[model samples]
Target: MSATTDASRGKLIIPVLGRLYSSLHDAGETVLRVVAGAFLTIHGSQKISNPFGAAEMVEGLGFYPGALWSLVLACTEFFGGIFIAIGLLTRPAAFAGLFVLLVTVWFHWVTMSQGFSGAEKSLLWAAILLFFVIRGGNRHSVDARIGKAF
Candidate 1:
């Protein structure tokens, strides 16, 4: 091929590659959202069913208003997970999860000698949620399908 043709082909390749990368990112985000939502839901369920235990655990860690905060966290995780799973109000749900994670990191993490510890998991989830908020749910999501229908 001529140099001009070769250069044009190379330019096309970049756009194609970018599109492929974007598709892969969307797929990955969907999978991550589903998995994380399920996991957080289950964890929240455990706390909801045993609020006293959750409160006690928080109290043990010396958190003020332990019971209230425990309940708030539990509800946020549970409902936010559900919203994320269905891709309904995904951005808001993600924001909620991110907020919870930020508080957990600030209040619970800074004092611990272990530094990150278990809070790392929540922090990671928070990052994922923020990504979802920015990128949005994929075509496979309820939001995509239902949103268009309405």
Candidate 2:
């Protein structure tokens, strides 16, 4: 091919690669959202189903009014996870997950002084949540569907 043709081909390739990368990123975000939502939902179910256990953990964490915080966290996890799964209010749900992870890191993980060990999972999830906040959900999301209908 001529030099000009080669350069034109290269330019076309860039956009194709960009589109592929964007699609992959969106798929990964969707997976992350679903997995994180499911995990949080299960954990929250445990807490809400057994309030005493949650209260004890809250007390151990030295949160004032342990029962209240436990209840709030439980609700946040349960409802937030559902919202995230459906991609309804995705930004808010992601933010809620990020907030929960921040609190978990500050209250539970920081005390150990062992960086990214026990808290690594939460930190990873927090990063994923932040990503969702920035990118929003995929086209499969309720938000996108609703947006198109209006």
- Highest-TM-score candidate: 2
Give the alpha-carbon lDDT of every model: 0.73, 0.75
Identify the candidate with maximal lDDT: 2
Name every residue pair that clashes in candidate 2: none
On residues 28-71, what C-alpha lDDT tens digit does candidate 1 reach at each position?
77888888778778867887786555777667556668888788
Q: What tens-digit string does per-residue lDDT give for candidate 2 at 1-150?
A: 356545555688465565555447667777887887788788778766765457777777777687887887887788888877878888888788788888777765776666768788888878878887786767768889898311
TM-score of predicted structure 2: 0.73
- Pairs that clash in candidate 1: none
Judged by whole-model lDDT over C-alpha atoms, candidate 2 comes out at 0.75
Report how far off residue 73 is in candidate 1 (Å). 1.4
Off by over 4 Å in 1: 1-23, 56-66, 117-119, 148-150
Per-candidate TM-scores read: 0.69, 0.73
lDDT of 1 at 99: 84
